[model samples]
Target: MIPGVSINEILTLTSILFFIGVYGFITRKNLISILISVELILNTSVINFVVINKYLYPELLQGMLYSIFIIAVAAAETALAVAIIINIYRRTGSVAVRETETMKH
Candidate 1:
């Protein structure tokens, strides 16, 4: 850990990772890849939230708590999404996202 590093560095790193994840989410055409990108983005924000709260507000871990909730929700979401994806792949020959959109309501 470099003592010379500033808070801005941490923020920048978090933002960069978030944007990369967003880009992945947008560009990926496979459901599995998109799900992975979502997780990446969620984790990026969690890292930012936890770091900000840890350094700026030590008494309250509200941000950390929110991150935990997000993790749980994301896990549940992934479970359902993967199951759906597997079903789709079994029925359809392709894992393309465009083919799965018809199932959406």
Candidate 2:
């Protein structure tokens, strides 16, 4: 069973996750790692949106709609990025960010 927690705890947890995502975004080099970080950031926003919608504006679907759109966009972004990375690897023979510089001119 989940422990009884307050709003403050939830917010703090979200904040920590957001920071972790930021750190991953800054420190990771692989395309997939950055994509996961982006999704993590989006998850934080979606959680906040749902919480506020449920508590502060119980009569509207705006937040839910926004969250849905964000999720869709994140999915599309990841798919497109992965496709590009695959193409890049097939042509260049490597996915490492540091090695893509040879084609930049």
Which tens-of-lDDT digit does each residue in 1-105 have in candidate 2? 125765677778888999999999999888678888988998998887776776668799898899899989989988998999899889888877776666665
CA RMSD per model (angstroms): 2.6, 2.7
Q: Give all TM-scores, in the order shown.
A: 0.84, 0.84
Enumerate residue pairs that collide in model 1.
Answer: none
lDDT of 1 by residue, 79-100 (tens): 9989988888999877888986
For candidate 1, the TM-score is 0.84
Error of 1 at 64 (Å): 1.7
- Whole-model Cα lDDT per candidate? 0.86, 0.82
Worst 10 residues of 1 by lDDT: 1-10
